[model samples]
Target: MQHDQPRPRRANKSGIRQVLFNSLSFLLIFLPIVLSGFLICRRYGNVQWVFIWLFICSAVFYGAWEPRYIFLLISSILFNYFVAIQLARSKSKPLLAFGIVVNLGSLAYFKYLNFILQTWSSVLGADFQPVAITLPLGISFITFIQIAFLVDVFRNSSDDLGFPKYALFVAYFPHLIAGPIIHHKEVMSQFTNARLAAISANDVVGGIALILCGLFKKVIIADTMASYSTPAFHLAGQLQPISFFDAWGALLAFTFQIYFDFSGYSDIAIGLSRLFGVRLPVNFDSPYKATSIIDFWRRWHITLSRFLRDYLYVPLGGNRHGVLRRYSNLMIVMLLGGLWHGASWMFVIWGGLHGTYLIINHAFHFLKRKIGEQSLSVLIASRLFSLLVFPAVMLSWVFFRSESWQGAKTMLRGMLGYNGILLPERYQAVLGSLNDWVMSTLHMHTGDLVTFGSFRAVLWMILVTAFVFLLPNSQQLLSEFDRSSGLAEDGHLRSRMLAFRPTAISAVVAAGVGIVVLAAIYAGVPSEFIYFQF
Candidate 1:
């Protein structure tokens, strides 16, 4: 698209944007009232009252996006609950299959219908217009949650789980949109704890701390990085030549942009849930620190990986089958996983690339085992090879971020040096006496190579890398506050110095962070979380 080209209008009344966690509508209005109601209900009334109030507020929170779609969400919950009831009554395979089919069918209709229609029209030269389907907010997450519940009920016959609690499970605002994909078992059990109805001082302080950290990540880091990443990808999408440094800058910038954005949203969600004495599952660990694609999946969007493993992979015979079958299964699962992110071929390619990387990773491991070598060189080789993990994952992200094939190709070409190199002008000063020789011999271009807001974009990548690689994450800092919830009980602790205790110092720090994040939010328009569309 040329700069002056008029934009094409979207289909009529496509969908209403949901309120963002960082948005004023959510922060100033929705959160305080809901938090108060939960505390009030829990204090004076029974646990059931607490659950009921949370569910009602959750419904309002979701319905506020598009009032008409609330029925669709409720209908999904009611329908799934009915199926679970039937499955509990009789352990019928056909009934379970029907329930799964229905859930998937609804998802396909709402999420994939437009993609399919558009593809078919392009292929078959059809003139038919696509249907104006409004994808209800969090439909993907909601559908998967219900499907998982139905499966569990079929397997274990959970007839007495009750409707209100189940409704709370589905409608809960925190994990409802872009989830850590909480299991019904984990959430329901927590809510039932007689002790959970009353709020703990640690939970309150720590939850606020986590929300503050999340706001900082979103408002300060991720949204700021978006200034560079968005335009870079847009330029590539337009098929403009991206210089080498420019492309890699865009790639690394987006990798962290998405990392912080989604993780921030997860932190906020977990914190919000924690406020009500519930803990949503951990969605992100330090995934960029992963040594391989396998480790990456383990750390990133973990609950989704668990879902695929339990519901999809295990059923597909998992590793019980021979190697070839296992590899095929792995590809199928990832391909579907990519498609699950969004109804696009770019996503499919992203999934496929990860699947390939996983296959190669497994192959390398298998070959190493066959060697049976305890030599120092083998150990060093293994460790050095681990370095490829970051670059490999970063490469995959280019495809994930770019919507069109040409755009992704353009970025990839630059990353691989098909595009000419552009050194930062400051680099010329560092080169000193060797500068003239290098300029002539190496053909390096030097100028203003990066731009992000008012600063050079590449400079921020340094801070982003250090923060992801060196600093303790928000959850880790708040580890002492709630040890039993989520991974705090078992996950790695890289540092103790950053522990967020409920001391005066910690209180001051949290307050300072909260003030900074609020100011940032007040200063700019908060961007929607990257994963919300998925």
Candidate 2:
């Protein structure tokens, strides 16, 4: 017996033409963004120009290649769009089932096939070399968003999708690169009624602010740390008696680097969206200050977590089944999530580690609740334990960050006090050259371990971290700086003792402008967003 399939809907000629127009418009819009970079490059002759070119090229290439994968992209979009329409029309269980299968199946193909093949090859000891598959840029995130839309559609929880709005939702340039992973229900309504006009001053200011912030994080903070971390890790096998200090320095630098790099991207995404008068949800909320692993997950890469919970975890029974089943579901979701990051065993292991940690955390909570003696001290102690646990996670990042399995293994072994035995003459020349390069790079004196520059970088990072943690939330700031009073209240004791002043606003604005100018001058070429790997 043959199964009846949902008939493919006839092409909407206007919709197809509009898609083409939208695609072309994106290319045209990017031209000015690129021209600005070219101008900067010509004027400064700096590495910053190289980054701008890289970003511009990546964006343009992806949009151009969308046609090559247009069948898949459009098919996925149509599948969800139609399903949502049908669900909104009536609660149809079959429509929902079909939508879920298609969404999940497409995601698995693009995201997991390589990882699956590799795992099977390793386990079976077979000489299986897979062909290199070109992934659509941002497919990882876009796919997740699509899946969530489908699930919501199935549940009759979403509105009907409009073709133009849906296309823009997926292809919107700012969040398109490294996403806050928007949902259809969240953004589609705005696009439908979008004001098509020249950019406003507020948008211009906000977009510039976001762009500068992203540049500062990627170029000044992340890239500088990468220079030190990359070389140190590369020479891990050669270091003798363990350069523990250097290792710690490199690792810590990388830790902060990834944070700023990712959080900065999210900030830029949100800020840019604001320019369009659409508010994208905040993705990072000082995640480092999170007191528990669960809290950290909620704050860090929050959109991804929301996607997993809504699309993957909940569908697989979540915690609704029994405890054992819930634990199993958590493990499965995390393992898949890890593999989603990359087609590497290291990512799988990373996911599994997080899954295990979460499971244990859940179990502990269960036990504590049963005993009914959970105290503030115990909570504080648990938070401390979680902080200590971060080093292990950081070490796992070596694997995540490495280019190859062998490189990661070598680094790991080096960290564990393993160095291949060799005659003094064998590695002497190589070691000497590496040492000279490092010494010169840092301008190190005879006894000074760190140069003044490195010290200053560290100090700057500390200050940034302090600001991130101590600064009031946006809501709080807005409340304090209420303009109706003709004087903004400063939330400091000294300021309270004195009084508010109109000059305070001008001073703040002047300081902000000065910082932006300084940051732009110091900013290097644009660094690639870290999530681009997935």
Best by TM-score: 1
Report the lDDT tens digits of candidate 2 across residue range 173-264. Answer: 56765688887777655432223133345444554445445545555566555655655555642332224345555566666667777866
Whole-model lDDT, model 2:
0.57
lDDT by candidate, in order shown: 0.79, 0.57
Question: lDDT score, residue 171, model 2?
Answer: 59
Lowest summed lDDT window (length 10), candidate 2: 1-10
RMSD to true structure for each model, in Å: 3.6, 11.6
Clashes of each: 0, 2
Model 2 earns a TM-score of 0.70
**How do the residues 1-534 of candidate 1 rate in per-residue lDDT, one tens digit apiece?**
111111111112213223568766678888999988877877788778877998898898788768888888889889988888888889999999999999999999988887777777777877657678766777888888888899888779343578998998999988877887877887787776476645688787767888888888987899877777777787898898888878988888888888999889888988887787777788888888888789999999999999998999989998898999889989999999988988778888889999998888887788778875576776777787689999888899887888688888899898877888877657777789999899878778765564432344556778788999998777677666667645553244555766667889977888898888777767654364677645
lDDT agreement of model 1 with the native: 0.79
Inter-residue clash pairs, candidate 2: 48-524, 48-525
